[model samples]
Target: MNTKMFCYQCEQTVGCTGCTGNAGVCGKKADTARLQDELTGALIGLARAVDGAETISKRTSQVIMEGLFTTVTNVSFDDAAIETMIQKVRAEKERLVPDCSKCQSSCGKTDEYDMQQLWDANEDVRSLKSLILFGIRGMAAYAYHANVLNYEDAEVNRFFCEALFKIGYEESVETLLPVVLKVGEINLKCMALLDKANTETYGTPEPTAVTLTVEKGPFIVVTGHDLKDLQLLLEQTEGKGINIYTHGEMLPAHAYPFLKKFSHLKGNFGTAWQNQQKEFDHLPAPILYTTNCLMPPKSSYADRVFTTEVVAFPGAVHIDEKKDFTPVIEKALELGGYKEDQILTGINGGTKVTTGFGHAAILSHAGTVVEAVKAGAIRHFFLVAGCDGAKPGRNYYTEFVKQTPSDSIILTLACGKFRFNDLDLGEIGGLPRLMDMGQCNDAYGAIQVAVALADAFGCSVNELPLSFVLSWYEQKAVCILLTLLHLGIKNIRLGPSLPAFLSPNILNFLVKNYGIAPITTPEEDIKTLLNHNK
Candidate 1:
């Protein structure tokens, strides 16, 4: 088949393999996907060239991060933005290796790989490289968020180049497996750096319950992965008769003391990342995207979309580096919100959801959790965490949570929790059955809890009766998944579908080596899991 530009890197893509003929399930045109692939290819080339350079500048790192991140699912739905990123990558390459233009012979080392070649490579080779590429793309989003807060880790930045360089090289499962785990190890540090930046800058998150209702009058909805941008928005819009509500991963921002201190910083407004198109369609408030998970806007709310940091949408107002959010605030006031307090509920009709069960909160109750487990009150632990989307099969997560044995503990994080977060799962041993461990980046906290439990039990993490049933949608999930793989944690069940970018050989390798399985029916999977534990 002569593939066109469309791709199915996400869980929900047209026809499962990829959207080559026309538009994607997310409504991205074929041409846009092609441009994004071009940008990614250029980024891979740049990283390969800069891998061991003596003097790679901060600018090189920043562009590499931005270029990879922009290709993440639903981040840049605009063709023009991808084109701009391609140009930026090209310019960076020109600056780094200016002699490329004058050289008589071409050195394939610094040249961009046609993405089609990757797509057509041996299935196993393509899958391994895809793992490195996609994993870093997701990690870059987190790195970008942390970078904006002025927190950067040298190792994290360097591993990004290492990972990218590997993507361009020919390698096998033996060579790639170590690099795969390396992605996870590096992602763990990257996540910790972000955790430190977030907790230190904003106080350690305390347990918080937020409502879904929007109070009367003007309000602004802030979405994406960046907290600093939301904090800045909250600051600039404070006391201006404007309310700030969270959307997507920003839902956890409500639990941060520094953010919650703002009186007008209101509650969350929607479900997971995938519902934005419908939810924001007629929304009166302006939405400011500080990071990823941005969908192309509907014409009705297009003018009201505002972006800051690297989250640019075509034609929407951008706040730029200065972070002056006057335009976003103005849009909110202009929209003027509801005439009365609008009462809304989650998928379960619950008016509120509680969050902020980061490592601090979970560890504070560690003694209790340990006692409960020792007493046989809590039998097993399930970490059902990752990004959520609109795919029909994603109901598997909600079903999986519901099907967990009563003696088990469920620790969830990220936008995926929205699927069943509103349900009153009640408590086990004085701890809520479902603990929202902050955003996707806060997987660091979940890992901390696992390690602490392992230490208490005097065993390795995999020996602590812990199971990771993960759902992935974008790049951040990729990084976290890599982290889990790096930890040598086996018997993971991933769903609702495998990445279309992964070749059959790569999938088989993961299955044979890591015991990674696709999600089956909840009953079947639960039975299989219980048998394994037994």
Candidate 2:
């Protein structure tokens, strides 16, 4: 147990369990991991101190959300950046508990939590707390995006402190269980907040085809999921002879009317975050990461990497809150882009992909979709969504989406769509069968579509001919999945593997109660889901 690093918070942990070595399977160093733990512990302390607020201020909530989300897997790797976050949380804690240290009797009201204690706790308890902790981390991303747009939900913000306090203070598995599910409940609110923030700020997304080709010339590749940053960059880069290409979760930006207005804002650069190391290695463009799913940069591409907001690597250029992307612009121009226009296809080898199918767009065509169902043109709907990763078995998503019957429509979100997004799925009733439903936070939109369809069909969502085949790699996906479970949605297929954080008993409980199962072959799953639909 005296390991240099102890982390199993992600799907890519060493030995398919915990990483107890010098480096994590995701390329996080022990030093960075320790700092992340400290950041998390400090955030938990802030949460503990600020507990029971009559009304949680947006500023306190912002700090809590950023601190929690910053510690999510593969988010931040710089010890310095994490230390800064630790300081922010500590300052907030001090602001809340000015007199706690001067009290006559000692009260450990806001003591910083030791993450190792949670890691070392009993298996079931650890599993529940992990769900609560990780779920909020995911929820925080949505909350962060919302806050960036001046949209804040007090309830969703309050739940963060409540959940973090539970992680630091509550000991019972029974006590942690409901809070674990409440993470799902509150995340639904968080996602809804983000959905409103985005649709209101950027306008409702419509289906838009995004080119995979990176145009010849100086261009900066923006990754992660911050739309505001992308918009600001687009504004700054406009007519600068510098093309801006979206990458990772930012691919959905191409569908936003406001962003797409920038003609020089070019296409997407890479598939998912996991491929950045390989994809950016030979790239002549600088990559600006605005959020998570950032891999530790390889030496070859390290210099081309720029991080902003909560994302960081030790040596990469850090864009401050001013949103001035000049460093990334300068880096991209220095790289001089390509000798000729570079055509980049997705993993499927298709030249283009479509996105922008948020809730409003989907519901606008709701009547047609419903009529198609009645006409038997669309027999089923598969919500094949969640984060994409580098694991071998992730091809299951591609195969699953590909193997879905022609009569079935695929509703997708997040970066996982890169697997088959390039593949032309054709159309059913004048609607593209493969509909991209914005970013991971837009899982709220997917939920809305599901609910609307159920309401139109006069049946429970579980009774509808819909299936959820999700692939999770990090905390955001965890919260989205929890939101699903919170809605009492059943018969979900999660893969390429279940989380290591879920103990045998806790996993068993999920299976028995929810009918959630790990994905098998695409053929087998398709058949099972089709039969279940019958």
Candidate 3:
């Protein structure tokens, strides 16, 4: 196999196999892919170095988390940025064991492990290790967000090094399998950490209606999953005569009291991240990407794109840690937005969408929900959530939501909801049939709600008429799915595609033990789920 690179970390990989040519399906070039692999290998070596240290510092864990996050699909595409990350990993290793590299004995313990070894390993081993690696990469994103908000969990931080060390050196199935499942266990804690950070900082999200109308004036469109970046932007742009609109995963920011207080924080701008290139074409407003799901910018609106945090693209203005929004604001003002309010609608052609149904908001009405459930007003619950991508079969989600029985409640998170979120599913017993539960990290809230429901009903979650019809695209979805599996949840129907990295043996194990299966047609799956619920 004479290939330029090997990458299957995302669901949209080439032909459901690895992306081995010049660029990945996410538009990451081969050079960038190679640099990311190198960065991962370097992080592994740093983890190995930390293993010998008496203690792991917060900074050490932070670097490990950042490095892992940097390699997640569609994140850092800049070779220079990836190389800088590699250097940061090495610098962290040197800080931990200054004299180790200077040793004449030259033990391989501290040397960077080549990622190609893992990529070329036995099928089952590769599958399991990929699960662990991808799961933590997703977990790191949550941990990073929480860390920015001054939340730190020593256990979560330590597991980064432990997972990296195992990925680099461990080969036994017995050893790696538990580590793979443990990624899910740790990620649950990480999501909870992020949940605490978000709710405490921004205030617990409440149900709020976010319009799709872009008010006339200078406006900046904020996308990706960073609420802190959105808050900072909201603060800096307040009273600047510039309106702010949430895009993609940032749509949940509107539900936060601290964020919604900004009068200029008008409404949502666009749909999921995959549609950005089309949606952003010649957009008059500046678009700021605070995190991943960034596509290669088309020349039309390339000049209006600004990246902050770990997100970097060549030639686009990069916002450093100083968090200044001058350039973005100035761009917004210069572009002079629409002459009139541009009314945008979701894919389902609805002008308004609602969000902020976090655990607190949902649980606040738990008594009502419980009464409805027991009275048969709400027959079942469907968690139709996960990442959205530019793929063919994703219409399955839109159709699935539409075909879901009127008596069932649709609990959604992440961008996948963009498919049918705007459709009027009506309400069940005073509650909207569809509830958007924040971002993908807000999967924590969904889990909390499920567990609470189960406790109220005196049964396990799997026995509570709840079904997970998830659509995954990238690593974040991977970690969330693993978290579900870790909790002993069963019969999850995942699509638009299963991960390419899953070997037949590992897939069989999951199918046999966990009852995980790829999604079939929405009509068939809905009928099957309803029948199963009965």
Candidate 4:
């Protein structure tokens, strides 16, 4: 029960359980892990203080969401940054309950809960509460992104505090069960909020073709899922004799009209976040990460990594609220990029990829899509998307997409699309069969497509010939999965592996009630999914 660092929140937890040593499997140091725990504890106290009648401040919302998200898997590796977030949480708590500190009588009513107690609790209770805690951590990232664009939902904003309150106060399994599922319910709204913010600010993403070439010139490669950060960086770097390339989750930025208006905004550079160490090694450009999916930098690229917002790594230059891009710009100029245009390809070796199939874009062509299905030109639909990771088993997604029937369409989002997005999948009704729906939070868009399809056919979502084959790496995927289950979508095929935190009882319940199963080979699972239609 005495563990220095215990983290089992993601698909890559060491030994399929917690990482209880120097670092987690994802390269988080022991000290960083402890700071994350401290951050969580402080966030809980902040949430507890704001639980009742007080109208939570906008800054309080930002701090709650950003602090929780900062602790997600690979998002923040800087202990100093994490401590700063902890201080923000404490300040917010004091702002909410100013009298608690100065009162003479002893009272422990609003004190921060020690994380060790939760870690040492009964396994089932811990598992349920963990779901609530981890699920919201993922939701917070989406909320933060939306908040940056001046989009805020009162219900979605309050849920963070409520969920954190439950995580800190509710101990019994029965009381926590509903709260655990509420995280899923709230996350859907949070994702929708982000979708509105992004689309309104950047325009609905259209099906635009993006190249994998790094144009000749000094350039900056931007990664992560924050479009607002990308937008500001694009504005700052315009007309500076530099090219801008998207990488990882930022690939979809190229499809947004508002961003693509910048002529210097070039093409995408590398693949998913997991490949950064190899992809960025000795690169002639600086990388500005706007959010999560940052690996611990290799010394080769350590000096070139620039982080903004909640994404911080030790020794990397951080851009604060000032949104200054001077350091990143100077680094790019010093590196002086390739002498000539360099072509890059995805893992499957295609020179170009296509994205921007947001819900509005797809539904705008809904009549044509429905007719194609009626004419038997399209046989089925598959959502083969989620977060990507370093595990070799992730190749399953690539193979699954590759082996899908030519008449079927693959709707993908998040970094997982890097596995198969570069491949040409042909088209039906002017829409490529393989459609990229932006980042993970764009799961909101995917859900919209599903609901629209169901309404068009006058049947339930599960009644439609659609299958979900998901690959999860982090907590964002957890919230999305819970949202799917909340919608009563059944028989999902999840892999590279199930999460390590789910207790035997919780896992069994998911299987029995939701018909969720771990994925087998692409060949067998695809056949099973296709057969279900008959």
Candidate 5:
């Protein structure tokens, strides 16, 4: 049967095919996903119209990024929020192509393309467009993160339009391949901008160990991707007798010296982003989401879900652009956390996991790492990181990390590390076996480490003995994957599920050229990887 709705942009789609019925596995209604597609299509049209229009304004670029980011998994589950974004996109298009509206006969030039067309097109065409669309969606997340700090890169912003414009046009692999790589190239710039903004503003992250224990008294649990919101919360809740515990992506915030300096700022609360529904339920403190990966809050903690900076859930208290977190603070005091200290362990029953092994921290210890490698202490480096989700099969990550040879080093970032971050993997040459490289947006750190290692060995990054086993749940990961591909990095094993968006032809192309494969059982996949290395 022909598909009714085309919504397969995440790891958890209905039936593991695509969500074609009334709602997606993520609970995104058909209407909302369609609007998201429309918004995306309009952005593509705008990009096409403004192809070389002198210069693209920051406002235009911000709207494009925000529009794309809103469609990411678990971000805006509300259809009304998407409607508002669609309107915003239309308004932006109107501003860009005002003359098109006055044409006596309708000019298809500025009109949005129905997403179903791309979904139902020839496999090759659909695959190429999916790359363009998904690639931009990922880039938008990095761009959005960078934008929050008032740092912007012109090249990155310009490429957003360029990539989107290509999605709406007819193009081949030979012609579109460059645009695909350009997405990765621009995403690298975007990540660097965010890295600079975060390090400069929050101070370079150090090798810090964060405890899972929640201190007694009033505390606030903050999640999502925005460090700015977490910093604002830290500032406002200071000296108020309320403690702040980082949760989910915010765990990395504790690694920053500027953020960690606050006495009230406590340690991390949960493992990864997917466990929020279970973890946040009946929690004594208010949970604040500054960005995406917000699960539909359960009634038990629904009232306690506070949002800020574009993260919105109906009926949740939203901190506005002014960034006043008074509501969240009030909720924290009202909730009045545990009377005594509560010890919380990770998935592995460990009480603490260390983070802050960002590019700077790792590169500073490069000499030690290289020496360890040369001395036969570190045999392989496995980058086992990506988005974490509720999928049952995602345990592959935990098992994969568990089964890696003792001689290997594990580098992880993003929410995915929650799966095995707590396991006591022991240390190699004074460095922890599992190094947390900050948040998902901090994929930049992993890239930085890979490049530094390659430089030390005087080899190309692909020549280094490193393997990336990624598990993606959202669009931010999409951009990072593309960046790796753009750098010509090969033999990546991606799972728990392939994105529903990629057509068979595109999948074949990636497999043939990039050696990308969906993960199998941990035991089997490990054997395959070890053999490949041999």
Candidate 6:
């Protein structure tokens, strides 16, 4: 079939290749995809303008981060919104180099890049640049969240423009490869920035059990990964006879001290982001999307959707920067939730799930954990984390976690944990066998825990008895994977499948150097991972 668009940035691309028809696998229309490409191209133009400028201001960095974030999969499907973003990006470039557009000579150095060039480039070059582009796109989400909390990192901000500039400028493998890997190195810092922002703003997360029940009352289900939006919604709905529940990646908000203190901040609603369509069909409460993991809303509940920040969809009431959630609050009161308290079970049939094993929480139990490992009570550690998707093979994660030895512990984050998070994995030496380390960005906490464990064991992280069996769906996973590779951690088993954008040569390089491979059967993978040494 002749293709109207080309996208393979997510795990569930059409037929494990590219989505090339009227709409992408995530339901992004071709026109919307084109606009996203244009937005991305315009972001590169803004970065180009920053090149000859005196200094990078906070506003310039914010524009770049917001632009790149808007283009991430399932973030913004509204073409009007994307066009507006493109205009904003162009305006920023104009502010940066005012005379470039007016100059008679017209060097075109500050002109917006044609993204089709990167898409149609040589296969290897395309793959490398895709790594840098998509990796930074993921990093932008983290940086944006931090910026909202009034926490900004200059190096992380500077790298955003640098990566975008390289995506449009550098081509050779030798020249691009270092920049590609640098994305991971910088993302580590970005994730850390977000980590500090979240913990300091909300207080360290503590282990808390969140119910899967939607109580009988007016309520709002906040999805995506924005805590600030959720906080605002909670404050506005306080004592207004409304309850708030989290959905998808926002499930971890229940663990934070500040959020948990809200009496109305009740439980979690649905499972992962992929299940939103069925789970939300005629859902009585409105869902507020603060960031990505947004599938196009089905007509049944489309009217009940509210979006804020970079997340946008046509017809959904968007809560702007003012953060007034009155519309969402009124809608919830109108819907009136369920007639009775409805108990919802996770994919594994458990009625409640626990989260908030952040690095601080986990480290507080460091003595117990170290003793458990030294005493042979803990055999291994498996981090079965990453984004969840609608793909079929994702059941592998559920089974992998289920089949883990009773003596082992599972460290998970992101929505992927919804698979087996409800299952009773029991505990080892006073620590629950399964630990939810907050959201996907909480991978920072997991890294910290690993590093601390390695230090306690007098070994490197690779020598510790820990493994990363990850499931990835979107660009955020791309950046996190690159971060793992950047840390030189080896033998990472990634699935439901490898990224479609990974060319054969790049895949080979990752496999040979970092021991990355697609996941196989639960039994085989578990045995191999258990017996294998790095």
Q: What's the TM-score of every candidate structure?
A: 0.96, 0.97, 0.98, 0.97, 0.95, 0.98
The Cα local distance difference test for each model comes to 0.85, 0.88, 0.91, 0.89, 0.83, 0.91
Give candidate 6's whole-model lDDT. Answer: 0.91
lDDT of 3 by residue, 263-380 (tens): 9989999898899889999999899999888899999999999999999999999999999889999999899999998988999899999999999999999999999999989999
RMSDs, each prediction?
2.0, 1.6, 1.4, 1.6, 2.1, 1.5
- Evaluate model 4: give its lDDT: 0.89
Candidate 5 residue lDDT tens string, 433-520: 8899989889988998998899899988777778889999877788889899988899999998887767777788889999999998
**What TM value does model 1 have?**
0.96
Cα lDDT of model 1 by residue, 1-534, tens digit: 133565767777666777767677766777877888788888878887786865557888899889888888777776677788899988898888896656777677787878888788777777777778888888898888888788988888888888877777766777876887788899999999999999989999988999999999999888987888888888898779998899889988988998888999889998997888898988988888878888888898888888776666778877878889888888888889989999999987999999989999999998999999899999889999998988789899999999999888889999999999988888997789989999999999999999999999898887887888899887678889889888878899998888887777777777887899988988998887767766
**What stretches of model 4 exceed 4 Å from their correct place?**
1-3, 99-108
After superposition, which runs of candidate 6 have C-alpha atoms over 4 Å from their true positions?
1-3, 52-54, 104-108
Inter-residue clash pairs, candidate 5: none
Query: What is the RMSD of candidate 2?
Result: 1.6
Q: How close is candidate 2 to the true structure, as a TM-score?
A: 0.97
Residue 324 in model 6: lDDT:
90
Candidate 4 vs candidate 6: which has greater TM-score?
A: 6
Cα miss at 94, model 1 (Å)? Answer: 2.4
In model 3, where do residues sit more than 4 Å from their true spots? 1-3, 52-54, 102-106
Model 2, 1-534: lDDT tens digits are: 134998877887776788988888887788888888888988888888877777888789889988987888878888888889999988888888886545677466688889989988999999999888888988888888889999999899888889989998888888998998898888988888888888889887888988888878898888888999988888888777899888888988888888878899778887888887888887888888899978888888888888899998888989999888888888877989898987778887988888988888999999999999999999999999988888899999999988999999999998888888988888998999999988888889989999999999999999999999999999988998888999999999998889989999999989998999999999999999999967
Better of 2 and 6 by lDDT: 6
Q: What is the lDDT of residue 266 in candidate 5?
A: 82
